[model samples]
Structures are given as structure tokens and as C-alpha cells.
Target: MSNIGVVSSCSCIHPLVHLLRPSIQKKGLHTAARLAAKDYYEVLVLGGGTGGITMSARMKRKVGAGNVAVVEPSETHYYQPIWTLVGAGAKKLATSARPTARVIPRGVEWIKSRVQELNPDKSCVYLENDKKISYKYLIIALGISLHYEKIKGLPEGFNHPHIGSNYSVHTVEKTWRALQDFKEGNAVFTFPNTPVKCAGAPQKIMYLTEAYLRKTGKRSTANIIFNTALGGIFGVQKYAEALLEIIKARDINVNYKRNLVEVRADIQEAVFENLDKPGVTEVYKYDMLHVTPPMGPPAVLLNSPVSDAAGWVDVDKETLQHKKYHNVFGIGDCTNLPTSKTAAAIAAQSGVLDKTISLVMKNKLPTKKYDGYTSCPLVTGYSRVILAEFDYNAQPLETFPIDQSKERLTMYYMKADMMPFLYWNGLLKGYWGGPGPIRKLLHLGLK
Candidate 1:
């Protein structure tokens, strides 16, 4: 019998609705024969987020749908890129959400539960309900963890009159409400000291708010402030130089080496600490505040065998395969990929990972590599964007003939309109393979 052939549920009739009931088994030992016999697959994916969805869909096509399974708990999936527009009231919050059932690839097995524990030694995973499933190959794409409580007074600060954050659907709409009601005083936006999914997201809203205020005639009355822990505006110097010019031209205050430590929503004040001078702290009064909270790899990865000291999956950065486990691969924010986390990075990683896994399945040495291609669409205003596409070395790998660091309407339309379609149709369907092909056609540069 082929190990990678069709798999069937023993008692469950509905493939999507029926789930493995809670049970405890570990290291492929001390498990009931019935449970162990019924729960096995050729390939197992550990997330339903961007990287997981794309890779699972691609894997299903390669190994046959019945041989693959994905473990994800959520029913609703959010197109997070559009949240910046949703928070600006330019796009409705409803546009960003979709039923997870609809987008999960046509035939892959969907286990609707959180992964409680990852066991690579036994090639099995423990679900939150305690049920266990074993697999020959594993893909880890569980993404990041958002820590709002780490900042003092956050759960309290959230939804306060002038406070807002675009990180969650619940609070995103509140940002537009706060922006619309503003009359005067300081409008503060903050970027945290830790690594976040989209490093540019913290300031994308700042620029949009500045534009909104100018359009609504409140720009003069309100002062725009961007407080960031980073020493500079952006990671890539070419883009950083362009962004500094933008903040200066718009008169938006840029405070480098400063971080938001607390949000005093009761008194409508925001507290900050100077990262350079450890003890120096300051509090600023605000009429409006947009916060980007600190983020990390999933909470489950803490101290796990698969994780690095920083709690990220320990993977070969170029191949995306786990450093110690040849059968395991990782993508997106959860992996120590040494690239800024973004959907664009996930898109590129998914393509590279999918191909490598297919080669490994065929009993071959995986030779594919991911070059750390990630893009950041810096939306400067309601109608303009600076699309920054680059590689591992901080070099501009422009997709178009024009300079990408400069703001343009065409790029804005791509971010505002084109990307969502590509994400929904091309990426989820396993047809989109990042922008490498497009870059080649436009620049005549091939490797």
C-alpha cells in the first residue's frame, strides 16, 4: 500500500464538520490502536493563515487532496492589508473578512481546531481538543502573536475617545470615528520596539490620517506625531530617505528612538520612553492616537524544541526547512526568515516552500531557495503610494520602469484594488508564484 495515498475518516461522515474528539497521546506511543490507525496523513499543515492556505492548496495539487490536511481554528479570514483602508473609512470593514470554509482549497482535509502541541520526533501534532494526528511531512505557518496587554493601560486605552489601532477588526473602525471627531490638540501615532507583521503599517495610517485631516481642514489645528523605536523611518535606506522628506514636507513630527510604553486613556495621555536613554520618559496629551502593539511568534512556540531563542521557528533561512528536522518547513512571521513580515513575503515564501516540499516528496534533495523578496506599499495619502519591493540585501528590485520609492497613483491603485483580487484568486488557488516572474519581464533581469 502507498503511504501517500487516499485517506479516509473512520466514523465521521461530513468531512468539514466532523472533527477528532479530544484525547491525549504523545510520541506515537501509549495511543489506542483505533485512534492511531484512523489519524494519519502524508502531509500536515499547521495553520490556515496566508502562508498555510497557499502552501496547503499547492500541496494538495501535488500529492493529491486526500493525502493532505490543515489544522486551523478560525472560521473567518481577514485580508489584513485592506485594514488600513478600512480604518480610514475609505473601505468598509466587511470587505476585509470572508468565511474560512470558502477559501480553504477544494479537497484538503480541514481540522477545525488549534494546535496544542507540535511533536516532530513522532511526526504528530496534538490539537487543542487533545486529539492527535500523525504525518510524514509537516509545514509550520502559524504566524505571529499580538501582545496588547504588554503596554500598560491598553485594554483600557482601546476604544477610549481618541484611541484606536488597526490591528483588530473590533478597533479598526474606531480609528475613523476618532479621526472624524478631532478638533484640535496632538494626533499621535506609535510604532512599537518589537518586530511586527508589517513594519510599515504603523506609519501608513499616520500618512492617511494626515491626508484626511488636510482634506477636512483640521491639519493646521491638529499636530501629527510619529513616535517610533527604530533609529530611522524604514529598514531600507533608499525608501527611508524618501519617507523622511514626506514627513518633513507634511510637517509631521518624527521622533526616532522613542517607544510607547503606556497608554493613559483615563486621562487621555500617552506615555513614551527614550530607547537610547533607558531612564528618560515623557508623556504627551493626545486628541487622537493610533498604536501598533508589539508582536512575536505564536505563544505556543515559547521554549518549544522547534523554536529559536527568540521563539521563532528555527528554519534554514534560505530553504525555509527546519534546521534540525528535514521533514519540517516554515514560512511567514513564525519563521526566522530574516525578512520584514508581510503578505508579500508570505506569498514569496509559499511558492518557494511548496516547490521544495514537492521535490522532497519525490525522494529528491530540495535545492530551491527564497531570496527574501518582500514588498511594502507605503500609502502616503488617499490617492498615492510608494511601492517598495526589494531583496535580502536592501537593494531595490523595482517591478516597473519608474522609480518605486516615489509616490504614484498607479501603485496606489494596485495596493487599493489589484492586490486583494490576486490574494483571493491567484494565491489561494496556488497559481500565483510571487512577483519574481513579473519583475523579470519588466526589468529584463534574470538569474
Candidate 2:
């Protein structure tokens, strides 16, 4: 079928087609058609990451095969939480990633192309090659984009020695190598000012690095420093208190409101800006630096009208529905939902989003509301983890009946040995829907 016909068939009217020259639209349409395809899906999901794949599977179970389609570019799907363990030299980087083709649920169409544009008014999405796919209902799960180049002189540090970021699967091993090579001087870890996928990840690796250095008898020479852009170590008070105690005992320097703006690879210097005072800057010399780059929604979502001022999907927090469009829903790190962006949170959101979207598709009012549950497994040392689980109110909503603020080996075992299995075999398979049931069972009507 012709590209224009394919796009038009999906009920999408490209704004660029009308705004730009006819020749440009014609050319772009051909590209978009080849990229998107003429197939009309009942539920079209953009980005086949954790939330997208999970939702697609659930929708397929409800509607049947060929009812759902997922648009994603990469063939490899990464287990991002394991990057911390990889940086700590606890797990190999290779072990944390798998081919996307292997994990995408059966009986669903996978469009191996990047989405270039979104047309909510017309209920269609434009693909990179200029094809358009139409959907009766749409789910946005494109996830966040890591902007490493935003920091000046970062390329030099990332491409050179002594500086590494655990955010990517490729450079995660470099973090362990840098930690292993460090003998003395300041080992600096930075948390950017922007919202990150896992808020606790930047510091989790720091604690692990500190513990690794101590185990190797280099603790006396190494000065571990955590430079964060936030006002406190953690947003939650109970967990922050526990972390402060660990910092004092480990002799790690904690510098709050410090944002990394530049890196000087030749001299091993990192420049920082005080967020409170915009123009003021500070430079620290370091032997090793681990950077967490600023992140934001993908460019396609940012440029679309469906996006908020912050460049995230404008959605109602409770319903996960687009602010202006009733047919559109969002999940994962891409939405401007008031919650900590993590896979665990996404797991909880998937259940809520699935129920809400399904009801909306059937012309029924959505009764399900997301509680903004998020979990961060703060790996303090090689064998310990503080499982911080909370809701929007910052109250501890832990699954186990025990206190979760304290560092425990059981939590570490769960993070290391159990959660990965749950993530792969259960969560992705459309079986695991957070710990809602387990929480109720554990409480046993105590309230």
C-alpha cells in the first residue's frame, strides 16, 4: 500500500504534512509508511521497554493476538537495576541485558523502528521512516533519554580513563575498572539536577565503591565523596536517617546541592554549580569520577502537543490518562507522574494503567487509581541492601511486615537473587502486579 494511504488509513493527519511543502510531505510520508506499516492495532504501544511490553501482554490476553503492536528501535532489552551491581563489580554487564526479540511476549506485533512523531488528534503515530500506525487506544512508554553531552568536557572523560557512568550497559564496566584502579585521592560520585530513572542509584554505587575499596585495603587512602544536586541524601526521612548514619560511619563526604556541570579529563577535575546560587561554581579534583547524566523524555514526546512543559507526557497521576485526550495513556519514566521513576514503580503502574485503559476502551469510567508506589534497593555493601518501599505520602508501604529502613542481608538476597527472577519471569510475563496482595497477606488484618 502507498505510504499516504497507510497513514491515512490509520486515521492520522500529519501536521507537518499540511505545514510543510507538498513534496516534503510526500517524501516524509513514504518514509513514515515504510517505518510504521498500514496495520491498524486495537492498542498501539510506543517503546517496548518494561511498561510497554508488560501492558501489551496484558492487552493481548484481554483482546487476543494481533490486537496490540509495540514500536521500539533497539533489539536488546536491558535490566537497568543491575547496572549498580555491575558498577560494584558484583555482576557482569553482559548478564544484565538480553535481546528484545526474546522478551517481547508472543502473539504481538513488534515494529522495529523508532517513533518520530505522535498525532493524538488523529489517533496515529509517525515512525522514523515516515510511516504512520493507527491505534484505537495508545500507550506511551518510551522511557527517559540520557543526555551525557549536556555536561561540558564529559565526552573527554567518558572516552578517556578514570571517569565512567553506570547508566549505559556499554560504559557500566568502566565504573568497576575505575574503582579497582583507585588507590588514593578523591573518588567522587555525582547526581545530576534532573530527575533520574532510579533516584537512589547514584549513591548506591557510591556506597558499593566505598565498601569495595575498604575490602581491598585502600579505604585509608581513598576519600569517598557524594556530590548530589538534591537538598538531602534521600527524599524520605526515615531512610535518609539510616543513610546518614552509614555515611558518618564510613567517613564519606556528603555534599548536597552540588551539581556537576563540567569535567576536565586532563587534570581529573569536575566542575560543579550550586543550584541555590546559579552562577556560583566549584571545582573538585578527583582520582575517579562516576557521573549520572541529566535525563528527560525522548525528543518525539517533547515535541508533541501531548507533552507537558517539562517535556514529559501530560497525564493525570491517578488515571494515567492524557490531560487533554481520553484515548491516550502513559506509563513508565516518560510521563510527568509525581512519583519516583523506577521499574518497580512502573510494575505497579502497569497494573493500574492496564485496568484504567481497558475500562476506557470499553466506554466505561476508569475506577483504578495508581498510588505512586516506588521501591529503591539501596545496596549499602556487597552483602546488604536497604529496601526502601513507600507510597506518594512517603509512608512505608513495605511488603514484608518487618522494618525496611535498616540494612539487611535478606533484602540484599532478594535484590540479588530473587527480584531479577520476578522481574524477568513474573513482571514481564504479566503475572506479577507489584506486592499489593502480599502486603495485605503480610499485614493479616492487623490494622
Candidate 3:
């Protein structure tokens, strides 16, 4: 457990509360100092994203209020899944965000700061503000780091009116703006060589743009291209088959094993290197360019002993517990879990971590397991979606009885309408699972 004196008997406020509210700095100075001397938490979460919020709520219910603490720096939290829709003009960017303070669990402490160091041996994390916080157990859900600089022209390319990306809440609306202005030429979308938070998002906007083009009578004038570094259209075989069919039927170009390496913004040109053919390079002109930047784990965990060489937290794929530290666990894009990173995957992971961490806190072996359940609602158009759900094996462990590989309006409505409600009201509020129960119920109790 944590150092016993960290829990105050008078106001019961944590040192982190003082970090935010300055009024407490004077009134609770002594109290804050006392807490600073110990600075311990029963359960400390390292992010305020979907997974961390879920953990805070779940832990509060299990261990009671004020026992959990979350270390995060952001004032606004984005429901990032909706960003694709935002770029598509189906959803507004404003609707994707909420204040972080308003959403964290009722009695949980919020430390608004970035982490600088992790000391697993002492169960402590060092913050950029020069404060040390200790925990009995730790959960990492810091998510993927977007390396926009790795790409040659990047944000500098924003000077070109047609260039935008859905990864940033600020820039995603620009994609819709660019599409709305397009008279036509080349509309290029690229998938990076690195693992991204939502693997399908790079192309989701492409389909939306294509649909917009068709609706606006510019489909015949614009050449839509999907240049992916991967050898295939998608990771899952079944979904890949369906997507390829859609591509051929739509006459969209697929340049497999092609990676975007540079953006010549002045000329409205993008450079692509052939992954399979190393020595060859091609430059293509674009009227509109959507780029997906290279992604990796956050720099805080880069050289830490808790992380793998690739900078992801090293955890058991099944249990999500740190390989070297039983009290340390991981969830979401930060973990080297060998699955597509998405909010939907985090939803499944939250369920497993809630059960496993409870057992670990009680000095019991965790019997709960995560099956690498993940879902990607692949939006093919303004009103069609191919709902891809699968497991660790990449097999089609679909939720609905109907062929989910096929594009349908119902799936689009689920993605566009139902998912945002579930995220805000259900998942972040500490529900035990994702769509598992509903999937099972729909399947007549079948696994």
C-alpha cells in the first residue's frame, strides 16, 4: 500500500488538489506539505484518456473515493473516434471535446502535469513540476505519441490549403474545409509505416471525401488514392476482402507498400518511397493531401525500465500486468499488446484491468484475461460503415449475426450515433465491459 500519512484526517485533500486550486495553497499549505512528504496513492493512473478515466471510476467504486489519483496535463479531452466524422463533416469538432476536470471520477484526485520520469522500484513517478508521487499500484494509459516531425514537411505544409490530418482536433476540421473547396485533381490519403491509435482512421476520411466528391459532382474529376505502407488494404483478412471490393468498385487507387516520406508544400506535391523497391521514389501532385504521421509511445516511457525497447510498456498481452512488476499494469496504445490501438480496444482493456488490479491489490493472482478484443467502425461513406470486430488471432469474431464485413447504414448509425453516447455515459463511467454482453446477447449467448 501507499505511505499511510498521505491520507489527511482534516480535509482529506491530496497534494494534487493544491496543485490546481491556488486558494488551497494558503489554507491547505500545511496539509499539502504533509501530503507532499508522503504523496502516495492506493492506485495511480498515468493518463486521463479513455482508459485512465475508466480506471479512476472503477477503482473509486472498488476502493472508495479519494483513494485514486490521475496524473494528466490536458484541460480538454477529445472523444477522438469522432474526429474522423468531424473531418467528414458529419460531426462537429466542438462536440468531440469536454473539460478534463468535469469528467474524472467524483472523488479522485487530478494532478495536472506531465510525467518526466518513472521509478518502478520505488513505485514513484516524477513530474515535470519537480514533485514526486508514489503509488501502491500503477496503470499506464498515456496513449500513442504523434511524431509529426518525422514526416518531412509536416505542419509546415499547412501553408498549402489542401493539406490536413484527422489526428489533431485543430486540423481535422481543415480536411472538411479543403474538401468543400475542391474543384478536383488528386486527393491523396496516406497510412503511415508506424502503429497508429486507430488504424482505419487514415482511410476513413478518404472514403468520406470520396462520398463528398460524388455528392458534389466532382467524383469524375478527382482521383482518390490510398497509399499505405502495409502490404494489404487492412490487417484482418475478411475485412480486407470487402474493402478491396469497395475500392475496385469505386475505382479508387491503392498503392500498397508505398510510404509518404516528404511533402513539397510549395508545389503541392508529396513524395512516396516504395517499401518493397528501396531505391525507387515517386512524387505525385495533389489538390488535397491527408497525411497520417508516424506514431510511437510517449517520450516519458522511452528509456524507462518498465518499457520495451520500442518504448511501449512491456506487459503480458493477456493480463496487462507489467512483466517485471506485478503492481504495475498497462492499458491502451501505450502497451505493447500486439493489437490495433483504438478507443474500442481500450474499452475492452479497461474491463480486464479493473478485475485484475482488484485481485492484485488483494494479494491474489489475477484470473481475468484480455482476449485482445478490438473494434474498428470503418466508415466507407457518409452513410455506410463496415464494422470490423476481431480478436488477437485476426479472425473475424464479429458481433452481429449479419455479415459485418459488408457496408451497411445501420453500422454507420451505430458508429455515428450510438458509440459517442456509450463512450460518454457508459465506458468512461466504469462499466465492466465493452460491447461484449450486447454481442453475446445478440448472438444468443454464443462466444
Candidate 4:
């Protein structure tokens, strides 16, 4: 490995040149001699999102600070769970993001570069800047990538007045604006065929738009329609039952197995294809359209050997450890965990991975398990939410010892007021894992 410095002939001095000159002068132009003597960390985390941040902080506390390094490109950390609220006119998009430096664990080296290649066979990762990072253990927490381009005419027309998506912060506010400006005809919301981070987010915005329209006295002329690729309002039966009740009461038309294929923003038309029967297209003219575009793992991660066939980190469901490579672990939306990908799910997974990774590094089998706990604060109206919490078995795991499927004002307040603060101060800071302890305590250890 050569440590030679390359310089361009430009007159302007580069920032790195100024910084490195002091070290070069101290070492008498032989600084490259000390390159191989540096000690790398024991663990390397590839992202700084919810899972990566939580896992790194927990792991750093357990295995000392100098033993871990996080490779993340973004300087800002986003609380993506709040993007839904932002799109619903309940919160600002700015509130959903924070400086990554403030949230990452103390003493953890933050490499501000993307991982270009994963040489997992050699326990090293190549950076886009041509730097190689070696680690004794690796954790892949690179979150899902929103693929707006996957849908025809999507990226181009997404920011148009009547068309928007809640998946990205840049376009989420547009969704709320479109809803505010909607006066008549059909208000169409489409759920893509691909897996999304928050599966309920698509329809959540629809409910929010419905409430917004009603509030603005436009509900009479606007026909609220939910075109979902899935068969039901929710995967879990309990929550689905409640959602169905709301849909029927609101008189919202629900279309199943209908996926958005393209958006004709010029004419305010959205093209949909029936998933069950390909080539069967349905065009719906809309006054406003909220789209949840296709999402998947980051392209770099998908092309790496660490990814499974579905382009997600291939990990054991219970352990959160890689199937073949015991030293590698994964969490969050990027992992093939067979559960709904939500910040709540990532919080639960953080606890499981924090313990499992520590045991793996000690040459022991992981005893910790993740029961696939995930929660979605289903906001049906401005002051109502059904806090749907469940496990891998789809069994309801209510935290407050009450029926969480019913819409309640308290749940809505919790989602709006407390959850955001909890996410930033508690979860991202590696303080809150999940509602498991509270659930256990509330149920008197019966659950």
C-alpha cells in the first residue's frame, strides 16, 4: 500500500495539503513508513441511519470506543419515521432531520465516504476514494434506497402540483401542498408493488389527506381512493379490521393488487397495472396523487456478496447475524428480517444486534433473539391514531394494556408529541430499545 501524496498543478492549495504538511514536516518526509503500524478497529458499521447509529453506540459502550468505526457518507441523520407526519401537514420536514455528527456515538471514527466495494472474504471494505478499511467484525445497516426512477414518468412529474410522494423529504411537503390545493375529482394514493420502509405510510397519507380535505370543506367533491398492491389495508389482521372500519365509515374506495406504473402529470392522470394480471392497465384521473415509489437496498450493497438474492443483507431472523459469515451482522430496513421495516422495528433489532455481535466477537453463539416486533402509529385523523404493535407471529403486542387497534386521541398525541423526541433523544442516542420492557411490565410478565 502506497501512501504517496498526489498533488495537482493548480495554484490553489488543497485543504488536505495544508493539514498533511504539518505531519510530514514532523516525520521528516517519511510519514508513509508509519502507515502499516496503525491499528484498525474491531468492528465497522457501514451506515449512520437508525439501526447503524443505535448499534454503533451500544457496541461502542460494550467493546470500548476505539474498537469501532462507522462508515457513513451523509453528514445529516434523518428521523424518517417523522416524514409521514411531515407529509400529512402534522410536522415540518426540517424536524425529521438532524446533524449526523451530533447523533453518532462519541469516539467512533466517522468515515465520510461511501463504501464502493465490500471485500467480505478478506474482511475489508473499499471506499469510493480508494481507501481500504479492515475490520475484525462488520455490521451492515445501510438503509433502503428510494427508487423513484423505477416508475415511469415518476421522478420528472413527482414535484408537479398534483403529484407528490412522501418517501423523500424533498417531495414530502409537496404531498401536503397537493392535498391542500385539491378541490374536486379523485384523490388517488398508490402503493407500489415493491417492499417499502414503512408499509403503512402510503395509506397513512391518504387518511391524512381525507381528513385535510374534510377540514377544508373539500371532502364532498373529492373521492378518496387507495390503490394498493397488497390485498388488504394491512398485513396484520387485527389492524386490518380496524382500518377497514375507518375506510368504510369514510367511504374511501379501496383497490387491491393495483400498482402504479406511470404518472401523466400533464393531464393529472396516473396509470396503474393489475399485479395479478400483467398488461392490464387502469388509468385514473386525479386532482391529487400521493405515491409510494419502489424501494430497495442501496445499489452498492445490493451488488456486494453480503446481500441476499433480494438485495437485502442476508441475516438469520433470530440472531441478526449473517447466514454464512458469523462476523457480519445486519439490521434495519436493509436486512431480510422478514418483518415490517419501521424505525420501531429497527429499535428492537438494535438491541438484538448489539448483544449478538458482542457474543459473536467472543467466539460464542448468539443467544439473543428478536421476535420481529414492529409498530405503526396509524393516524386515521388529526387527533386519532391506532398504535398497531405486533411480533413476527402477527400477534398483537399492545404496550399500554389496552386495545391498540382502536383509534384513540391519546395514541395520536403520543405519536405526534412524544415519539419524535423519543426517536432523537432516546432511540438514536442508544437509550430506548423498544416498548418490550414496558409491555412486559404492563402485562405482569405474562407476555
- Give the TM-score of each candidate: 0.91, 0.91, 0.91, 0.90
* lDDT per residue (tens digit) for residues 1-447 in model 3: 001110000010011211121211111111111123348888888888877888888887887657778887787777888878888889998887887877777667787787889999989999876789989889988877777778788768876698888887657877888888889899999998888777888888988998999999999999999999999998999999999899998999999999999999999999999999997989999999998888878888899989999999999998899999999999888899998887777877888888898888889988988998887889999999898988899988777788989999978887877777667666667763666766787799988
lDDT of each: 0.78, 0.79, 0.79, 0.77
278-356 per-residue lDDT for model 1 (tens digits): 9899899999999888777787788878899999999987889899988998988788888888888887777788878
lDDT preference between candidates 1 and 3, better one:
3
Residue 255 in candidate 4, Cα distance off native in Å: 0.4
What are the RMSD figures for all models against the true structure?
A: 9.5, 10.4, 8.6, 10.3
| Model 4 misplaced stretches (Cα beyond 4 Å) | 1-39
> Per-residue alpha-carbon lDDT of model 4 for 1-447, expressed as tens digits?
111001000000011111121211111111111112233668888887877877777877778766777777776677666667788788988876676777767676677777789888988888775778888888888888777787788788965798777777668789888877888999999998888877888888889888888888988998999999998889899999999999999999999999999888888899999988989999999999898887777877776798888788999999999998878888888888898888888877887888887787788889989999988888788899888888899888777778888899987777777777666556656766677776787799978
Q: For all candidates, what are the clash counts?
A: 0, 7, 0, 0
**How much is 121 displaced in model 3, in angstroms?**
0.8
Q: Give the RMSD in angstroms, all C-alphas superposed, for model 2.
A: 10.4
Worst 10 contiguous positions by lDDT, candidate 3: 4-13
The segments of candidate 2 whose C-alpha lies over 4 angstroms from its true place after superposition are: 1-37
lDDT of 4 at 162: 85
